[model samples]
Target: MSHTEKEATLYRMSTAEHQCPYGLKTKHLLKSNGYTVDDQLLTSREETDRFKEKQNVQTTPQVYINDKRIGGYEEVRKHLGKPLPDPDEKSYQPVIALFAMTALLAIAASWLAFGSFLSIQTVEWFISFSMVVLALLKLQDVEAFSTMFLNYDLLAKKWVPYGKIYPFAEGLAGLLMAAEFASVISIPVAFFIGSIGAVSVFKAVYIDKRELKCACVGGSGNVPLGFISLTENIMMVAMAVWMFISMF
Candidate 1:
């Protein structure tokens, strides 16, 4: 019996140059879960390679209970009933978090600026702040954002460069709108881009029925293009129109 029910044998790489983070995590997890861990360290590259060959396994951080092999970090987590994250899983969590954060920011701004939390100004601030944040996400990795944006954006597909310029334009419009500065420039800019975006989103999702990732929350994420994407564009257009109408 190599291991008891409450004992686990963990094989991991521990060298001068590098230590496996997953291996450490597995060891910690085993200890935390009331399991006694027998940590077997592979101190060198050759030793690690030899262990892999001997075990007929490709990776380290292997766990065993009652002499039964339990694979790597992810598999160990499964045995411990604490599964790791699945990267390919499609989720609305990112967008939901963004909206929730922006909503709180909006209310906070309203309280700070007007000593109130609920007002037409609050709504405006929410939209403007969202624009700024959304643009900031895109600006984080413009190349990645552009690569995703071109997948469905009508204008981006035609012009190619519009994808790269979009983040700056959105940010500028948002700042100007938020400050109520340069309305002459801001309103038109917002309306133009917003309208184009709305139409493109509508056509792609509704007309073409092509399910693609939205570049709204930046390209690195897996936010599916749909209702929220449409709403974002519509809000910008509405904000621009409202500002324009108010000028009269």
Candidate 2:
């Protein structure tokens, strides 16, 4: 009887050169031991951002056994002596409900905070800083999207990954957030934010083809991009109009 070769595990090392020496070694050794290898080498900041979003992993050198993490280098090395079925890996959960709940609450808090900060210089700083942040994120998203055109199967053909898109959408959301901070813009801002929230709720339910990750209201990670984007834009425009009305 012929024996079947064990399936090679999947290991993702950090972009950092040092954090995953063991993972690299494991890849090499696994090949020697007759197993296949898949490597997710992240180079762009946006790629790193997507990995973070997908895994909710804060650090790099994340190693996975067939999609499960055997921890990092040390952990993998330690388990090297174990049998092929290590049975000691963790599964990655894409949608974390607790995180999603926290995000919703944070968005609510942001509206209140921005509303209170409008009279202060923080509004200007938040607007400018938030734009810069979102712009950088958008640039990264564009680059990632372009790469996906050539490798559609590897990456979903979405315009941008959810992690990257969230920040882009947030740019518009921030504008509205900023408007809410102004005393003259309060009612408009409230209405705008409220509108965004409503649309977000609707989108979360209605969008069928949506695969984008939610980056709304503190990374609540639930709202869909379609609804949230529209919601935020509406709020911002409404706030601007309300600011005009409040002036009189």
Candidate 3:
């Protein structure tokens, strides 16, 4: 059929009490695709239920073209030969949010403690708090985090228990750094883990040339396994070295 002849009939739920976002999206999609839509609004729960029963469909936002069923948003995309966005697609949003929040908290704490927002102390606090936040994200689902970590971490691959202990160790190091106490333990811990992490990431991304997800924040994270992961380890190493120098 010609583009001008292409037409769609959309049936969706719209009522005084509620409006379906999916329904709105479907209509917009049809219009964007150059289809003239015959919009059918089911204004009540009974009307929606009856329509579903009559159409033998379980969901709202049903679309049709030339009396041929095109389905909902997902199926419509498929019918138009468009790739549907994967729900499990990787994203850096979580890590970005964690770092942003940590920076804000660090600035607030530094202002309260040292009366300076842009001090060397603020950078220290930011790294420490960021580590703590990242560790907390992993701790939320240790099992999942460990599974992802084992994909590339040398220590985790060999000694599975290291994966389990990693979050706690990171959190302990972060807490110690934040409190400016127990440098004797925290320094070595941070240095050791950071060194190991740096090596593992280098081998995975550089040497092996593998495209993988980072388990730095958590197992479910979509953070890429390169720059951000390396930066995190480098921050730990830097913090450890700084803390050690401050001690002597």
Candidate 4:
């Protein structure tokens, strides 16, 4: 496409950004490309979440090229053939929301059940520690667990298969986490800290388009992988981290 045609083809960009340093570049990009922008500039609770859900955007400075989802700022710069801009520093609003919501839920439950956060914390430590140990063992013992003459659905046929079991291993970790958390546990703090590492792995897996099975509580049967899994894992990690930090 000719430069003018390319420029003409570019439509108004929809962006979700705060009044931050990075947001300035987004504004500059829009102006340079001759595209109008509608930055409603979300700050309050309702608007922020509505903006996020509407765009299905988990990160800041989300750019839609010609109404198609491109990505956040870096992706936009890459597409434009401009030297990729510094990775736009994004707000941790989503992470903060997860933490706040969990705390609120725990506090509400505690009030109704035990009349204090103290009881929740005490029981939570024991349960969390137990789960962490159990999850560790399950991961280390996967071969023995996966075998034992597996059958799909009670057809009484023995099947032995070898497949990478990391998803299940992660799921077991998540499950044990849930079990530990069921006491309305003191917010999954350790899970949160571990989540910092897990998020990187999760992102790599997503970029590679690897199918990951859900080993979380209950089941996620046939669900296409996406942000929810990452979010859940992060929440679990956050709880784990919080608990651990509180201990020190």
User: RMSD in Å for candidate 3, one decimal?
Assistant: 4.2
Candidate 2 vs candidate 3: the TM-score winner is 3
Superposed on all Cα atoms, model 4 deviates from the true structure by an RMSD in Å of 15.6
Model 4 agreement with the true structure over 38-142: per-residue lDDT tens digits: 554555556656767786777555655455766666776777777842333333343344445555555655666677765655344333443344344435556
User: Global CA lDDT of candidate 3, please?
Assistant: 0.92
Angstrom error at residue 144, model 4: 13
lDDT of 2 by residue, 45-75 (tens): 6776787788787765555655556655556
CA shift at 120, candidate 1, in angstroms? 2.9
TM-score of each: 0.83, 0.29, 0.76, 0.28
RMSD of each: 3.2, 14.7, 4.2, 15.6
Q: In angstroms, how far off is 72's CA in candidate 1?
A: 1.2
Q: Which has the better TM-score: candidate 3, or candidate 4? A: 3
For candidate 3, the TM-score is 0.76
After aligning candidate 2 to the native by TM-score, how far in Å is the CA of 18 from where it should be?
6.8
Question: Which candidate wins on TM-score?
Answer: 1
